[model samples]
Target chain A: MTTEIVIFAVLFLIVSGMGFVASRWRRPDDIASLNEWGLGGRNFGSWITWFLVGGDLYTAYTFVAVPALLFGAGATGFFAVPYTVIVYPLVMIVLIRLWSVSHVHGLVTPADFVRARFGSPTLALLVAITGIVATMPYIALQLVGIEAVLKTMGVTGDLPLIIAFAILAAYTYQSGLRAPALIAFVKDALIYVVILVAVIYIPTQLGGWGSIFDAAQAKFDKTPAATDGILLNANNQLQYVTLALGSALALFLYPHSVTGVLASKNRDVIKRNMSALPAYSVLLGLIALLGYMAIAAGVTPIGTDVNTVVPQLFDKMFPDWFAGVAFAAVGIGALVPAAIMSIAAANLFTRNIYREYINRDATDAQQASASKIASLVVKVGAVLFILLIDPQFSIDLQLIGGVIILQTLPSVALGLFTRWFHRAGLIAGWIAGMGAGMLMLYNVANPATHHDHFGGSAFALSKLGLDTKMTIYAGFLALAVNLIVALLGTVIAKSAKVVDGPDATRTDDYTADQGDPRVHDLEVTSST
Target chain B: MTTPRTDRSPWNWLLLLPIAIPLIPALFNAVEPRLFGIPLFYWLQLGFVLVSVAATLVVYHMTRRAR
Candidate 1:
């Protein structure tokens, strides 16, 4: 084996060891309980939570795909920076309320909160199913990130992926959320160091920022499309804004993002971490610039996958040893978020589907065991998604995933502020939002790729009977339809005297703090 | 559950600045006005990250103090 491959293997082995050892990092009294295993006993402080949440949100896919998108299409790819930047403030208002309410009610998933808040099991079920569906593609894309690195290293076939994931499944099954939490520290540190070095070193080598942008601009200017330049055009301007805004709305709604927040020890941990987490956004902006650097270097992407650009850039630009480190950083980055996404999806299933549908009175041990098994199933499903399906299509499906998850914003985010929207109304809103989102996704196609359905997130404004040639984000339009349907449904339900379900949560639940009477009781009981 | 602190404070209103900054595409949508060779569109959006972090920290500290 080459020295690069040997170093990559060594780093991979180190992280895998960290995953297993994480189970004992903060050994809970009842390791089999859902609270302990599913959420690291909800005892993580600000520093650990910062790394964990950062690792969870900024996945290996971001490392690979952001630059890939930028390399393929210039300014549009930078939407990710603004998306992540705005997401912090948006979630600051939304997620703290979620954390407070979830802590008071002992809710483990966003769907759990949905069930309690709306008093509608059906709505909660939709939320759970959406969470699972949206996350499946996301997990698959993480595999795509790792696959890019593996392909760069000449590691082919599904065997390596299956084995790598099997190890991830085993540790996550044994360690639960803590596995990713512990591994995130290393994954994030390596990524920060590698990216910081690459940004500084690569620019100097490429004859500084001016030449890099000049090269990028020159390349894109040669392209016939008006939207491919260094600056946004009239056509893409709306698409860019809507994509960034829709993505910000959808980010925290994902079960994994909420899982990361709920895993924190207290509300203050979340508050403090939100302030600190923007440091990663700075990293993300620099990472996105790597796409420009790839352009300046004239690195040709391997195959049709733009995702390979970053890995190929590293291999061509850096020394073999440092290239291996960068490759491992991307690979390890996949493992951290993949582990968390599976755990979050599994929690949704175990809590909402398995327990809600299969056995209402399952013991804590049974719930934890079921989640572990479901987590393994989730990993296998993600691997199969990559093996059997087109990965480029999977990337598009992630955009569709964002659209689907945004449908839940009304129920989860708005429901936090007021219970005014009727449960039936919320249910109807979800259906309308989901149906419209999926239909739009189906009709939008990329002519170049020849994909007939689910091609991309940008839909033409003219499609809605407008005369304009510009396109807006499909998610934004679908969300608008969803809100209208929900409002209309609320009026109809109210006039029809639809009986509201019994609310299990109390008023104080939304504001419950660490030492509040109700929160303290649950904490004391869970620890014992 | 009952709503938690429905009234908004002026400090809480500052959090809206970050969310609002990126939504207005016209503000930083150009390329001619570059900062240190980076386009206005890119650098301004990146600069928003610091502005956002600062805004969030202020809101956090103020809200925590109020409580």
Candidate 2:
């Protein structure tokens, strides 16, 4: 093996060791309850939540696919920056309410909140299924990040990925959420260092930032006019605004994002982290520029896999040792989110599906055990998903995931703000939103990639009989349909005096603080 | 939902500025006036992140006492 591969192996082994030893870090007497196993005992303070939620939100997809998008499509790829920028303020509005209410009832999943708020098992089930389905392909895409770095290192085939996920599954099963929470600290440290050096050092190796932007501008000047430019145009501008706003709205609705947020100990932990977590956006903005850096360095992607462009840039610019560190940063970045995602998915199953449907009498210990097993199944399923699909499809995995998850926003996010919508209305909205989203996605064809259906998130206005080639985000349109149907449905249902399900949550529950006496110790709602 | 300050705090309105600031095409659409070799398009959006942090901080500070 080359020195680069050796160094990367050593770092990977070290982080894997950290994952194994993480269960003992806090050393809970017994992690056989949902709160203890799935949420790190709900005691994480500000700094840990900052790292946890930040690490969870910004995954290997951000590292690999984002830069790749910038490298390929130019300016519109920058929607990620504004999306992340808006997400914090947007989340701070609704998520603090979620945190307060979840703590008061010891709710473990978004579905749990839905169950209590609407008193509708069916709506909760839909939200749970949506979260799981949306997150699965996203987990598979993380493997693509690791695969890109490994491919850059001249290692091919599926063995290495299988082995890496095996180790990740094992520790997550043993340690649950603590595994990812502990390793996030190390992941962020390495990512920060590598990105800091690459942004500062690599520019000097080239002419400078002046030439870098000039090179990028010059390259885009020669490309097609559709979304490819150093700046936005009228054709792509609507897409930029709608995509950023839609993604920001969808970020916290994902189960894994909620998992990270729900693990925080109190309102202040969330408050402080919401403001402080944008510190990473500074890194992400710099990281996005790595695409331009690759352009400046004349780094070409391996075999048209734009995902490999950033890793290829590292190999061509940084020394072998630092490249190994960068590779490990991305590889570990995948693992942290993957572990959390599996745990989050598993929690939804155990709490909302498995316990609710299969075994209503399951105790807290039984639920925790079920969650651990389900986490393993989730990781294995994600691994199989990557093996089966085109690894190049990582970009769309996230897009489709975003489109699917945004359907739940009307139920989960708007539900947090108001109880005006009937439960039946929320259920009908999910179906309408999901159906409309898929139909729109089914029509989005990317001729470049030769993907005929579900090819991208940007839907052409021409398809709807508009007089232009301009496009808007599919999720944005789907959300509009969802809201309209829900509004009309609520009016119809309320007027008909259709029996509304009983709401278990009190108004005060939305504002409950950490030390509130009403908050249950564990989510062992055996007979709610 | 009934909490007076949590739901109705006027300070909460400040948070909307950061979110709305970036949506305007006029704000960061130019290549002129680049910073450190970065264009206004790039640096300005990164600057919006700081804008959000500041807005969230002020809201949190102003409303924490009410909680």
Interface RMSD per candidate: 2.1, 1.6
Best by lDDT: 2
TM-score for chain A of every candidate model?
0.94, 0.94
Clashing residue pairs in candidate 1 (N, C-alpha, C atoms within 3 angstroms): A506-B1, A507-B2
All DockQ scores? 0.60, 0.67
| Model 2 chain A worst lDDT window (10 residues) | A519-528
A127-166 in candidate 2: lDDT tens per residue? 9999988887778778778878888898777665766677
List the candidate 2 regions with Cα displacement exceeding 4 Å: A380-393, A520-528, B1-6
Tens-place lDDT digits, model 1, residues B1-67: 3545432568878888988887788888788788778888889989999989999999888777244
| Deviation in Å, model 2, residue A509 alpha carbon | 2.1
